[model samples]
Target: MAFEKGGENAYDVVIIGAGISGINFGYRLQERNPDLSYIILDGRHEMGGTWSLFQYPGIRSDSDLYTFGFPWRPWTEETSIAGGPLILNYLKESAQMYGIDKKILFHHQVNAANYSSEHKTWSFDVTANKTEKKTFRSKFVLLCTGYYDYHEPLKTVIPGIDDFKGKVIHPQFWPKDLDYANKNVVIVGSGATSVTVVPAMSRTASHVTMLQRSPSYILSTPSEDALERFIRRWFPVYYQHKLIRWKWIAVPFLLVTFCQYFPSLGKKMFRSATEPQLPPTVSYSPNFTPDYNPFEQRVCFCPDADFYRALRSGKASVETGVIEKVTADSVKLTSGKELHPDIIVTATGLKVRVGGGIDVSVDGKPYNVPEKYVWKGVMLQDLPNAAFVIGYVDASWTLGADATAQMICRMLNQMKKEGVDEIIPRLSDKEKNTMKDAPLLRLKSTYVKKGKDVLPKAADRGQWQARSYYWKDYLLAHYGDIKSSIEWNRS
Candidate 1:
């Protein structure tokens, strides 16, 4: 069945967010169930999601493009690490090439979604362009909203930040007219954003100082993959792409595995790789060393060692200390060291907002996500015909998203075969009481810890367990018993 246009606001499937996850799911739907009518609704004016939203200097993918890019549409670029504009273009091109672009409705924000048990359908309250209200209906709803809050970043209260005379900027809302040419800049974080911004801003600014309370694991990787290039030269395009993508996926999986099991060895490996990249003046301890083990928090990656190069050139530097207060002209550290800057960039972390902050209810009763356990890391327990995509923390997000897309498609097909109107993951009261509670996200990062209350709950056993491995999840999605712990209904 083809989707009706004009006044029609109904679909067999409605996917919220035209981001990477939504686009991938749309393709899977077309491939797996061509007769199903579907549409992708995005709140933003553009379709690139994060790539389109973030306009910070030197914005780029921390993960390699080979794995980050869609599985069907391979990233053929020479460079594995890519800039924002390049990635945005790739997404747009892939969407257009696959006819996914035509299936999207931009500027349509889904505010609330309610499931009607009697009707076996979902009704969405939507706001168009921040004003016009509309309603849409679907048999199945997929939230591909990603994890973070788009409107607000994670709040960090810097002591007396109001006293700072210089311009304070957050990377999320970078201004186009803001100029920092030959100006002193201080970036207040040691994460990926800060690492990226320091190097890029150093090119034009008089000086850039990355101020961090503590250091994070930072590794430098080659911009281009020589092995991929060699494979491209010898193999057919199909095999070449497959080989390259698998290589990227397998290597990261192995690395994350090693880090998780042999944390000491992983720390050693990271320290060895990072120590050589630092300048003579900077010591490995305090400045480069992290208190936690590698992958405990995500390891920051610097392509072609751009960050190190900036530091070596004396254009940028790293400072490790606690902020005491901010004076009119400078930031006062507890150690008595003061930094005077014309611009302060708060490259702090992101705020997690699951389901895009959409109010979800079933039969007019509000559903609390954090209280509910996730079934198969895709669907929530007791939620009928609904799923949300939360990607892998250890590997590429697309890998997990693809796994989810395939799994959801399988469920939809099964429903058709069984002649069921609705499918829900359910647990008996005894089983729910006996199951142990676990966190949905495995990371111990500050943002993850802070946003624990906003995320879905998990259990330690069976289908209730949170996502751990891509291959394991992939196998489960394909061949695992879909009937396990699930209930089917006809309305």
Candidate 2:
């Protein structure tokens, strides 16, 4: 059903967020069951969740577009690492192409959702543009919130930060008119945002300094994939796209496997990729090389070696040290060095929120999200008629998302055949205990570490553990028995 303002609340399914995952879920679910009534809701003023929110300098996709793009929709963009504007356009085009644009409600934020055991429906209380609470009802709720807190980034308190005189900006809330031209800029944190901003800002700014407490493995990739370009030029559009997509998909699997089995080899290869890009005067040890093994934290990807090029051109530089204090004109380092800057950008990671930070209750009892175990990395244990669109840490986020969408579609279709009203993945007492003892996310990133307590933990057995490989996920999504793990109830 197309979404209308102040329309009826009832639906077969309600998908939250109009981001990459939500748009795909709406398209895939409808493709599976055309008669299924569904609506896409987003709190933003328009479509494109992450693509719309982040308007910082040089914001781009960390993963290549072929693997990141939906399987049904081939990404025809020439560049593998797309700029934010291009990515936003791709999302908007997908929405319009799949008829999902008509099914979306802007300025509608899901506040809370409650599951009724007797009625076998999900009742959602949402606030429109922070006012006018509305009620929506659906048999199933699909959370495509992307796991991050949109309201605020993961801002860590730094001593003497208040004393800094220059304009301090977080990439999440980048000011449009903030003049940085001819100004010295200092960016803190060594993640994706830091690497992206350093090169972009350095082009216009007088000087840019990337100050990091620790280094992360950063690799420079060509903006366009050579193989994808060749295929696009030689083969038919359909064949070219599919072949290139599978090739990009296999690249990540091999990289991750090599990193897991041979740590030294992975580290050497990663270092070698960046070493040639740096100037001879600059050393790779302290500021460029990370002490941890490859894949411990996410590998930061920069296109066309822009970050390295900026450093070589003497427009930007890197500093690895702890912050002692932030003076009015400079940031004092623990190593007794100070960096004078006119602008400071905080590239510190994101704050992940489970279930879009919406208060959820089942059977009138407040449900603790972190306490639950995930089944097939989609549905939470004992959460009837619900699934979260979470992605893989190892590969393109959409690969896992696509797999989960297919799995949900299969489950919903099977439930209809069996005349089941409520479906919940339940674990025994022993299984619950096992999950409680394990970590929710295995990543070593700062954002994951900070929000681990509030995320869903993966179980050790069955369809509970979060699988990273796409082929394994595809086989399970297409052929796995849903009834073996789920508890089905009839109306």
Number of the predicted model whose TM-score against the real structure is largest = 1
What is the Å distance of residue 442 in model 2 from its true position? 3.0
C-alpha-based local distance difference test score of model 2: 0.87
**For residues 1-491, what per-residue lDDT tens digits would candidate 1 score against the true structure?**
12223446989999999989999999999999887889899999999889999999999998988989998898989888899999999999999998999999999999999999877889999999899999999989999999999999999999989888889999999999989999999999999999999999999999999999989888898976688779988999879878888899899889988998999999889888988888987778899888888887888899999999999999999999999998899999999999999999998899998999999999989999888889989999888889999998878888899999999999888888778878899987777778898878877788899999999888988779899888988998889888888898765
What is the C-alpha lDDT profile of model 2 across 1-491, one tens digit per residue?
12112448788889999999999999998899776889998989988889999999998998999988888888987778999999899989988988889999999999989998887878999998888899999889999999899998897887798998889999999999989999999999999999999999999999999999999998888877677678878998769888888888888889989998999999999878878999876789898888888887888888888889999999999999999999888899999999999999989999989878899999889999888878888899889999998887878889988999999998888778888878899887666556444555657888998998889887667667766578988998999777767798876
Q: How well does model 1 score by local distance difference test?
A: 0.90
Name the lDDT value of residue 406 in candidate 2: 96
Q: Assess the local accuracy of residue 76 in candidate 1 as a C-alpha lDDT between 0 and 100.
A: 85
Candidate lDDT (C-alpha), each: 0.90, 0.87
CA deviation > 4 Å runs, candidate 1:
1-7
Model 1 TM-score relative to the real fold: 0.97
